[model samples]
Target: MDPRLTLVVISSCIALCLGCTKELSVGELFYGSVIETKSSPSAKHCQILCTYELRCAIFTFSNFKCELKRDDSGAIRAVSSSIISGRSLFSCAAEKKEACFRDEYSQVAFKDKPYQTVRTTNEKECRSKCDNDPLCSFYTFYKSSAQCELKFWNLLPTAEVLYSSTGNLVSGYSSKLKLNINAKYNCLSIQSKGYLLENDYFDYTYSGAAFTVEHCQTLCNLNPFCRVYAYRTNGHCRLKLIKDSHTQGAKLDYVISGLRQTDCKPNFVGKKTTATT
Candidate 1:
């Protein structure tokens, strides 16, 4: 066999095996404070810096500034409203991963009223909030409203089959234990639904198919950034890459809407040193 083909075969087999071992950082961000202002672009950058530092247990980023810390030994306070904090995951470790599945082109809604309501900036943040909260399990996100409707269930949620294609409304599950692909990604979508306006309204669709809502969702789940999609009952599947935007709103009934499952997977460059060394 050709060397490249052999490599591809090995890769495929590894991905196909459900029991494949995966390395993950078990670290969690406790808290952080502004230690110094260093030129940086975003909070992700600061996180990468903390991952590289030997003692950097936590980090904060705000107003184009980066602050790194060794531990939360002092009063845990935010420098300002803009400060974003994160911690290294070396302390936490990844075990055998599970397959992650989300309905990209469909959502499960309950007739029961939302148990709690939490304010958030986007879909990913809302999912994280739900994952962290002990009481939350299922949630619906209104993209136009920037509102997250958190719902709790003693068991799995299986209810009404309401679907939307062009609307900004989306639903998702809490982040429990899903497999990490090991690639660095900045955005993630848990689920979405809806499709239409084919002549020429939104022209960014990469492909179309005679697909069902469930099929559309699987396509979206395969992509790291595809949170939105339009699906029709006629089997027309329209894949979209229009990422999370705080300003986008719900659309017409002819279209069904979908949203991504979670936010960006926290990236760390220092994880290797911290874990292996």
Candidate 2:
């Protein structure tokens, strides 16, 4: 099972009973982050945009005015709306409603033999425990048993098998992935500020990826449509689009093959780098 499948309990049971319901609607206030914050109302407008965007788990309105930010991960909300706040959608029913975490998933995993049971207070704490232990990668929390389970291996069982506590048990796998590459590799010769010898990879996220001369060459070689490529020792990855594909092993601007593959052991990238995963 994926570490994100674990369930966390909230301590707000008592709080939920005492507090009056403060329901939220599509147009209601949703706390979010202002990806760009040059002005005050930018955050508020962002909130509106978030409301329009489906699949948006939640949003934060903060930073002087209201900043609209997306929270699909449903993990942590390191946001500041200067005002608006929210509890996890999973925790909306807790007695303390907004005071406890109620995410169905946690970032925890097993280490030794039979996976041990866990009882985390929230998703964050569950993940924190797994992260602290390098041996962990994924976790499963039984909603009924209120137990968190961890994993140390790579296994993907069906939902039927996973949720079936014998019938409804949660099951997941470690996110850590070990990659092995063929020797005929693509490599970049690094100068100051560049990867001593590195390669770049982009999951197609607009940004958050970097490349090097050698890395660019390797990327092109591995990819078909890599007619031209560029690299910056700036520690940031940038890939350009070329009309061509299948440009086999051509060197351009210090680009070359022989670069070693960097093992991506998902340890903290969130999507697939949590140390336990």
Candidate 3:
């Protein structure tokens, strides 16, 4: 081989090897040190573009936009449902793909009607059916009835679509759909198997279905006006606003409630009281 050609081949191999080491981290959004921005159709494409950009060290892709970053060392990593972030290896390489799914919520179901219903022997089979269907984005499995409900929508549904249900129900979403499940909030405390702080002064603003008590708390946290939340095992969530510093409570089976730590006013306090129904 010619000396010049031999040197060129060795350089090409090094570049290829460098690119093959890049790995992806899904559901993470990295902030700062953006060197450039480009429109990409997918996370994989954004990663490929980063590999070709000499200055790109890391990239975050979301909603068809890609941001190339120079330094990820001090960058803040936030959990996001839509954003996908990865570090680049400074050379072009094939994108790696993998099966990804979000954690499942027990005793939960989607309020929206499923696109298709199939009778399955177990939750695994139900999940398999959803995995095989191109249109399925989320699903609910009823253990008692041995039925799977495959759900679909033009876009991913919000947390409001989920509701607490029978103990036999379970629900989950595909990570590819990128549903927003990570909301920042802290609970002062969670009361289980009963509702608290229900009184005339603290009337509920509205009610909806929540997949879990945490889901209900997320909804309350996102609502600027929400001060307290109550969740029932039957898949019901109630958001409330309380003006009084003192509140009363009652016993209700299969119900849980709590106050958001951020919303706990200095004067506001919960007073649990027994009720005979």
The residue pairs found clashing in candidate 3 are: 163-210, 164-235
Clashes of 3: 2
Over 5-120, each residue of candidate 3 has an lDDT whose tens digit, in order, gives 23333433444454544567788776646766875545665765564343456789886578887554635566877888876644332332222345676776766688789999
For candidate 2, the 10 contiguous residues with the lowest summed lDDT are: 266-275
- Stretches of candidate 2 off by over 4 Å are 1-27, 30-132, 135-138, 143-148, 151-192, 196-277
Question: Which candidate has the top score in lDDT?
Answer: 3
In model 3, what lDDT does residue 71 have? 51
lDDT of 2 by residue, 1-277 (tens): 2222121112122223334323433333543333322222223333332322222234454433333343333344333334453322322322321111122322222223435557876445555555555546455655556566654432211111121214333334333322111112224332222222232223221222222333333443322222334443332334433333223333333322232123222111111111111
What RMSD does each model have against the real structure? 17.9, 17.8, 20.8
Question: Who is ahead in TM-score, 1 or 2?
Answer: 1
- TM-score of predicted structure 3: 0.30
Sorting all predicted structures by lDDT, with the top scorer first, yields: 3, 1, 2
Q: List per-prediction Cα lDDT, in the order shown.
A: 0.46, 0.32, 0.58
The model with the greater TM-score, 2 or 3, is 3
Segments of candidate 1 deviating more than 4 angstroms: 1-111, 157-159, 177-277
lDDT (Cα, tens digit) per residue for candidate 1, span 1-277: 3332233233233223423222321232335434334544445545544433334555666654556665444345435456676654333324322323233222333334677887889878878777787556557777777888876542122223344555676676566524232233445533323323233226545455422354454444444445455655444546555534332545455455555344443232111100100
Cα lDDT for residue 268, candidate 3: 12
